[model samples]
Target chain A: MSTSERLIESTRELLWERGYVGTSPKAILERAGAGQGSMYHHFRGKPDLALAAIRRTADEMWATAEAVLDGPGTPYERITAYLRREREALRGCPVGRLTMDPDVIADDALRAPVDETLDRLREHIAQIVEEGKEQGEFAPGLDGEEIAAAVVATVQGGYVLARAAGSPTAFDAAVRGLLALLAPPTR
Target chain B: MSTSERLIESTRELLWERGYVGTSPKAILERAGAGQGSMYHHFRGKPDLALAAIRRTADEMWATAEAVLDGPGTPYERITAYLRREREALRGCPVGRLTMDPDVIADDALRAPVDETLDRLREHIAQIVEEGKEQGEFAPGLDGEEIAAAVVATVQGGYVLARAAGSPTAFDAAVRGLLALLAPPTR
Candidate 1:
């Protein structure tokens, strides 16, 4: 659409594929079908555009997780749905991948959205877990925050494993294993 | 160290920090305290040297995991020790980080060690899980392979979370959560 929108969109895709260090302003302009003048006219520089892109990606990630977590279902069902939801396993999580970028982590401004997104996801999962406990669906003594952190870690780690293996089996297997572990104990 | 040995060591460190695309021939030579001729004298080029580094990193990763998985105490204890082991959380896993490198994943030759290392780890963990099942330390019906994959994912994912937050709390919490899920239900 607009030059600004195109620049932000292009920055998001490039950042996902190449990371901050690997990405260059020239490449972003080329990808966006915009020129140097358009880029500067639209934003101050790469960092400014990148911050917008990171925030957009973070917001998108939260929205996707929020839909599943807040969707109508039992707490366990919702958690399972979120895990089983389709993903481009090899590409990895857009937000999660940013964590590996040295340039992104070194800058507080760029890193804030990344940290906030993960923290919010953990909290969202913890809320669902607490609801499960209240409904007598989960062990009352279980700590929701801890379990939520584990859920997030498993998903992130699953991406790393799947990418490492060049297949999605490890990813699927990890999800299956986590679900099993979270299954209610049979008396 | 010999020229070849120094070259390989330097390549390993560079690969860990900057990834495949970001690492350069000149950079590797400089880091190794070797000359350009010395690099070519030892290896064919960057790819050749990288393979050595990848294999070395993979072997080192396995050795570290094996020590814990094969060490003292029961299956549960071993698993817990491995999860709780000290790590440079922000730096990420040496071998695991390679998975994020587009170049490494694109080359079959480069990807072999990464795949093998992860596969062997899953199998190693699966073996322990199976033993735990047989010993009646875990639920009999749990799939050892699935649980093993989940355990591996948690560690990989833990790194992602910790790096995102610039703290180890999420990583530690994730471990605590998984262990809680894995704990045998008390009647």
Candidate 2:
């Protein structure tokens, strides 16, 4: 990969592991095996680099989510598939973890990608649920937006519980519980 | 406040906002209104003081949760109360945030209170769900443990969503959605 690619990749990993405040330019250089001058030549600074990395993470997150949400299945089946999708529970979530970082959330430029990703994902899920209701797969009165939020919460919060216990068991349980509650299979 | 009390309180605040690696002895001392030597006099070091602060946070968390879980009400009501309980959503969950801190999760000493609190809380919620089942308030087939995990995840993940959007609206919606699904008002 080019110096630019390596830098962005390193920033993503550091940002995930250390967060915005804890990550440093020197650490990024060392991790990416690029010199200080190379960093400046490629990007303005750490914040610029972090934004690039975060966007990449966001793009990747949305890609995976859309694949499932927009996949072939009823709203209930697709939603369940999305939740049960294998995740790195111990690592928490790339986008969700950023919300915990004060530095990331404090800056609008840095936060835009993060916010957009979550907003879009939730909206996409909501649209799917609405489609389900139209198709008579879900109750007519079910609130699509509210259900969307619950589905997103289960996955994000499940990581927290799983990490605390040093296992993915809690995360899996949360998904199962939510699945049982979601319009269960009537087939 | 006593120097020890002041130090513990300051550590708690810093931990909530800054996390373990971001927190420093100097910051803790400055926030607590104590001198450097005073901090050393009260605790062995930053790690020791952090453990104390974490335990205190966990203690307070349990105190609030139990007040409702053990209060005079049905299981569904108590569970709903716990989810709908007012929170500093933008600031995020104090204990849950720690799980995202690499330094805290890396150390068993620092992680104990966090892990214990979440474990006990899930178990407590699970026990309440079991009661709901026995009381004929919920379907007997519901998995108490899974439901408890979902409840905890909704709160933790809800905070993530709220912070991401810079609004508590997402968090509130998630709770409302979960409530509508959980043992509906069938009197």
Candidate 3:
């Protein structure tokens, strides 16, 4: 890979592991095995590099979700697939983790992709939920937007529980509970 | 407050705002308005001081939740109360945010209260769910532990959404969605 590509990938890893405030340009250089001149030559500074990394992470997350959400299945079934998809629960969500960094959240430019990624994902889930509601899959009173919000929150919160307990059991249990709630009323 | 109290309080605030890795010894001392000698005089170092602060935060979070869970209300009512409680949603949960801090979670001593706080809260909520189940408030098939886990994850994850959007709309919507799911089976 080129020097710029190496720098972006290294920044993504550091940002995921240490957060924006904790990640330094020197560490990025060391991890990327690229010199300072290379980083500045390709990108303006740390913030500029970080934005690219974050957008890349956000885009990849969307692609992963899209593959499941838009793939073959009923709306509810697809949501289940999204939840049950294999993940490193302990490692946490790459894009979601960035939301916790004050430095990232405080800057509009840094935060845009992170915000848009979540908003778009939730909206996509909401659209599927709307389809389910129209098809009488979920109960009538449930709001598509609200239900989708819960679905997204469960995934994000599950990571927090998994990390705190050093296990995926809590995350699994939470997802199980959510799927149970979303079960078709024919039961 | 004593010098130790000031230091602990300052550390708690710093941990909440900046996270463990971002919080420095100098910043903690400055925030506490205490001298370097005062910090060393009371605790071994940053880790020791952070533990005390974390425990304190954990205890307070428990106390707040217990007030509603243990209050005079039906099980479902109590859960709703817990969900609807006033909060600075965009600032995020103090203990929950710490779980995202690698420096904190990696250190068993530092992570104990954070893990315990979430575990204990979920367990406590699970007990309430059990009571509601026994009272015939919820559906017969639901599991208390799993349901409680979802409830807890909603709050933790809600903060992520709120922070990402720089608004409380998503968090409020998430809690509202959860309450709808948890509504008594009579509906």
Candidate 4:
């Protein structure tokens, strides 16, 4: 990869592991195996480089979600698939985790991609839910947007539980509970 | 408050705001208005003092949740009251946020209270859900444990969404969605 590409990739990993406040420019350069001059030549500064990394992370998250949401099977199946997809639970959601970083939330530019990524995820899920409601697969009174928000929250919150307990069972239990609720009404 | 009490309170605030890696011993001392000798005299070091703060936060969280959960109301009402309680969304959960801090998660002693607190919360909610199920309030097929996990995840995850969007609406949407799912069957 080019120096710029390497730098951006390294920044993404650091930001995921260390958060914005913990990650330093020096660490980024070292991890990328690039010099100070190379880093500056490629980007204005830490925030600029972080923005690039965050945008890339956001795009990747969207692409991954789209693959499942827009893929084969019914809307319910797609959502189930999305929920069951492989995740590094202990590591937490790459984009979702950034929300906890004060530095990221304090800056609009820094937070935009993160915000947009989650919003899109919720909206995408809402659209699928809408389809389900229209097809009579879900209760007519159900609100697509609301269920979508719950779905997103379950995944994000699962990470928090998993990390706290040092066990993925906490995460699995949450998903299972949500799926049970979403199961087609038997009554 | 005593020097130790002041120190612990300051540490809690710092941990909530800056996380484990970001909070420093000197900063803690400064915030508490305690001198170096006083801080050292009160605790072994940062981690030790941090444990006290984390425990306090956990206890306080339980106390607050218990008040709502143990209050006079239906199981659903109690759960709803717990959900609708006022929170500082931007600041995030005092205990839940620690899971993202590598320093805290890496230290078993530091992570214990956070893990136990959440686990206890899930169990507490599960018991309430079980009561609801037994009383024909919730669907008989519902797993109290699973629903409890979802409830906890929603709150923890709500902080994530709210922070991501820089608005509390995202959090409110998730809660509303989950509540709708838990609503008594009309059919």
Tell me the TM-score that candidate 4 gets on chain A alone: 0.97
True contacts kept of 1: 0.81
lDDT of 4 by residue, A67-92 (tens): 98998988888999999999999999
Give per-residue CA lDDT, model 2, range A1-187, as digits (tens). Answer: 9999999999999988878877999999999998999999988988899999999999999999999888888888899889989898999899889998888888999999989999999999999889999998887878999999999999999999999999999999999998888855375
* CA shift of B40, model 4, Å: 1.9
lDDT of 1 by residue, B166-186 (tens): 998888899999999987665
Can you list each candidate's DockQ? 0.79, 0.86, 0.84, 0.85
| Shift of residue A59 alpha carbon in model 3, Å | 0.5
Angstrom error at residue A132, model 2:
1.3
Query: What is each predicted model's overall lDDT from 0 to 1?
Result: 0.90, 0.91, 0.92, 0.92
lDDT score, residue B37, model 3? Answer: 99
Better of 2 and 4 by DockQ: 2
- Report the number of the highest-DockQ candidate: 2
**Per-residue lDDT of A131-151 in model 1, one digit per residue for the tens?**
999988889988999999999
RMSD of each: 1.6, 1.1, 1.0, 1.4
- Please give each candidate's TM-score: 0.96, 0.98, 0.98, 0.97
In model 3, what are the clashing residue pairs, if there are any? none
Candidate 3 TM-score, true structure as reference: 0.98
Worst 10 residues of 3 chain A by lDDT: A178-187
Q: How much native contact recovery, as a fraction, does model 3 achieve? A: 0.75
Interface Cα RMSD for candidate 4? 0.8
**Residue B29, model 1: Cα distance from true site in angstroms:** 2.4
